[model samples]
Target: MIGFKLLHEKNHSSATHKGTGAWFGSKPINVDIGQNPVFLLRAPDGSVGAAISSNDSANAYKQALITLVKNTLDRFSRGGFSAASLEAAMLGGAENARWKWDRMLEIVRNDFTNIKKFDEGGLYYRIIHFDPKSGLAAVSRKKANPDDWNPASAKLSIESGTKGFSEGHAGGVVANATRFFREKTTFTALREVVIPAHLAETPDAPFLFWSAACSAGAEAYSYAMYIHRLLTRAKATCPFKVFATDINQKLVEGAKTGVYKANKNDIGEYRAYFRRYGELDGDTVRFGKEIRQFISFNTFDLKQRPRKKGFRMVVCANVFQYYDDAARSHFLENFMSAVTRPGYIFVGPMRDPIIHALGLKKLTKYKMFMVE
Candidate 1:
């Protein structure tokens, strides 16, 4: 069932500063995805202003609305539609409308389970229903379970293959890095930036690389392999540590072990890099003396502030898109605070605005912004 609600009165106060459009007079229209569609329109006052029950309504109308949304999205692209126009046009056709939250909740509860309120310390918390596939739906707070308050479990599904993890975007980061840096900058230049001269000086000074949102461990391992090759080439006498983290602990653990199903395209360079650094032992890729001394792995959330600092470089690639503007800014500020001066920050492609807005200079190499 689709559900929409206006920003709660409490949320309105925060939304203004958070840059949420719902508090800026933009109403939210939620459309549910299922065999039968259900739509709810919520006002700015956190009240359900209109409802369209496609399960009981005419199939033709539901199909028509679905077609309209699809066509509109296709024509204008995802960000092109005006919410007001779409809401006005869609709700104009509703009949026998009702405004009963209790009844609506009752009807939806019939087949849904684990319905509860999910709060991530934000203004956008909602009541959800837990489904097998899409997982959980946000429900009102009163119906939520206190024991199920953990956001990590709520966010990730039990299945593997990066279904619920941030791997897809992390993979996109690798692709973008390949495009922006690999093609544009030489491997020698990348080695210099990533494995900087200062880091090489203190090769055993417990250097840590945190991939804050490492998905399926590809990027983290890629980094580990890169460092291994650098130290091996230099014939360094010390080891460096690399830590891969994710909100999902399972993926983080997987990364620590360094075992993965290798796709030829994705794992090729990583394998070659590993060959230079150390040896691949069974499923796990182990680092040698030069790289192993500096790398470690752990689970971390970007939203949370890191307890320690003095990291030489932090690779927070491509994780910012998951956050809204305010959250992004807060995390970036925290990142700035964590890295020591002359330390490097590697952000994803889409994060130029936040990166540049903070007055961080992009390291230039051959006229390209190169961050290791």
Candidate 2:
């Protein structure tokens, strides 16, 4: 866990903005992984134990499960037996049987019985790994890939292991997401903005984009507005698609509705988002069909299986700082895999190091990157 912190903080160019005023539990609502991703570990009485991973996803349920299993096994083995020995004995065979690991995963799977599915509009949480050999479990707030899951249950026992986006930290990144496009400096904007413009200009090309963790569709709509502007100026008739996804069903629906209840600070930006795409009726802002037509909103979990089609651009901004390095790598791999060779990925400014580490070339001084 300590080592991963070093890795996550590796390319963080800015000082870790020392947060003040009761930082703990101060997470803002409607932000990814800020409050909703919950874990319900089943207790012996057939009841469930639930907790939210408000600070970091990695430390939430993964660590809790490890501790729960370890304590349970320690009590079981107090007659004097190693955790591994107890696990092996409970499985009625050697470690090769994989019974010990399977049981632990089963406990986790059972807890999800009440949770909803992506298709059924279920809750989204990622079970990164359920390793019996290492006695470690990793669950976080991303979508899960069904193909990667192993249904078999395991005997509970102690195991050792090491383990986003809202408000102060998230606010900074969200500001960056909107700010990146507003830069008027030609030197910076020309290089950064031209790429998207160019992509939309390709004759008859279907300009497809995916914005992960798109809260209430603001950022995704921003991209649509940009594409609309570029294509309109170029007189291009290229078909385009913007797939905006979030784990929350309510947020997805709200994004689809394209209605935003704007605060005082957001009035200007909300008005901008309404330009050519939305309308402002006093304090209420509603998006028009013109821009909304280009975008499709879905309840998606990035940790689950990815989309089958490739995209020209992928924007996962203002949300990367919440996870550890491993989850960060998962996000990059998913993004890179989902796009074509000559594609681009736009993340928050803080993720520059992780992007560089992945061998992507930086486009702007801020957060955009291109596959080299």
Candidate 3:
């Protein structure tokens, strides 16, 4: 929970730290004709973050950045890493020193391509804070605090039901890169191994599946269609449901409608199944009551305990690759608690090695972890 405040005026300064401990660059101090813009950088995997309270001169900015880069690699314990390998963001320069910021920004642009800037004309008083563990860089002109933050809870920058884009955390839910049937290989594995075992074990028992981080209910509906077809073919009298949850309320509401627009190309191999589950009109697909009945969509965060448990399989197909070692372990432990003894956890194709490190047996073919 320790935090450092950076205020650069006459000289350049830098700070780098481990998880949860934050580095913040407050409003720029005006000592000379030019003011320093706060520079921030983080590794691609969200492992380490470095912040530089930059000097107005381009050479000072460049030197401070390069030193911070080496220090960041040391923190990551990676021998081969540079600022070019990091995501960058810069914020808050003096309004009159906008011209000086141009050269310093150019120096930063040479090192980072995936960058965010808030040093514009009106953002002069803006305060920027970054938590590397959560990959949160909150920026606002209003009084903001990063010290009183819990990495597990996103309550610092935004309240749960707030409207508009979430500043630092995962962009915004509206622009989610999720659709029906993302991570095709993971779904294939779900059918081949997990489904059959669940059906055979208790032919007449209620079957349950939980889709964590289900953006817009792509995987949730896809699971419903697949299970519905399976139950029909097997002719087994078993009650079943898929519980889909996301942290964003807006996305969960949109998913409840079960209306997706996907063409033949986007539908790909699941086109026929898509037709079976919903009323299809060209590219507009409406999943009516038939498919919608099997899924219960709600706004739920993985960090919180589920009200219901005993999920046969918990498919958290994405989001792990963005987390660091400690974060991945924390989430995985929470996931384990909500699953059955003989259950499985699907963590997608970009698999986390910690799955095996935690000694959860791997269903290697499907790239999932067995709880037992």
Candidate 4:
């Protein structure tokens, strides 16, 4: 109570809202509201911090939910936290908004089903003290806390509202996207896994990465942006290129144009990268020469072997789940032969079991499996 700051609900009629000052610091903060909810978040590293939400509005829960999710994702990318590595604890929904809150919780659960810990359902007035930098928090009931607050400002809605959180978005923010909507991916593994692994073992020249199932080129472009950010931040312009291939020739042709439709969530999750590497024209996202130079799109079936060898990384996040074990093994064998030793192979969860079943060992320090 002494150090924790209070946050207010947004008022649709007014353009102003409180709590920006409170959210600026690393100290614990509390939200003052009636029957809405709060979300506390933590990065998997145990130092990313926490959150809680409370607002006043009879029908604004859905609006608030989308806003919070988008903002949380923006912060996550800036902090270098992956969706798989992000954790969340939700609190503060009362019986008054059970039905609405239940739907919101479903979205959160789908995104973070494997959370560090989950706690919810506090009906009465309560206070939460949360640290965002270290993810430390304490929750307690208050004897005389005020829960009545009116909407004091305007409601903010980004393009797409709740539509961005589709099943394809995958809330994991950490999952690998392969142009497949159901599997959302992010700036994952690149900073914490791919770049580090390359620097550690194979700092070879002309570092090559493979996007085995590039779809419409979203995955390839994402990889290109990720690689550029890492290399740029390091101040090392090492020669590197991404070889993107998909069986679909039409998709490959479309990829050469380097444009895609980004929903509100895509824009949110990829806000930082898009700003630096691409252009946003309303809902359309287009990448220019800077990012395009690092990647080449082509048509190649996973069942066949690539003539080129010594690729430093391979990301085939799709097509595996649809294949039989034999087909999976064949594709794996072909791609594995193409990668360099001490390199990496990133697959999706659907393909994870086949990988383990084939006895392909995963590196202890990274999400990718070794090339050799």
Q: Note the clash tally of each candidate.
A: 16, 12, 0, 14
- lDDT preference between candidates 2 and 4, better one: 4
* Candidate 2 segments whose C-alpha is farther than 4 A from its true place: 1-202, 269-275, 350-357
lDDT of 3: 0.59
Least accurate 10 contiguous residues by lDDT in model 3 = 148-157
lDDT of 2 by residue, 282-370 (tens): 87778788888999999876665686556777877544434444555667778888876667776544243556678887765544666
Q: Candidate 2, residue 360: CA error in Å?
A: 1.6
Worst lDDT run of 10 residues, candidate 4, spans 153-162
lDDT of 3 by residue, 269-302 (tens): 6778777877778787889888888999988766
lDDT of 4 by residue, 155-179 (tens): 1012221121222231222112344
Off by over 4 Å in 1: 1-190, 197-206, 235-239, 267-271, 274-294, 350-353, 364-372
| Predicted candidate 1 versus true structure: per-residue lDDT over 1-372, tens digit per residue | 223233332332211111011111123323221112233332223322232333222213335444433343344334443334232101111011111112333343432332332123221223222221222222332211112322211122122213323443322223112111122232344476646654645656655555556655666656665665676677776646666666767666665664445545534545666566557654445556654445566777676788868666666654443334455566666667776555666553323465577777776552223223
Best by lDDT: 3
TM-score of each: 0.45, 0.49, 0.54, 0.50
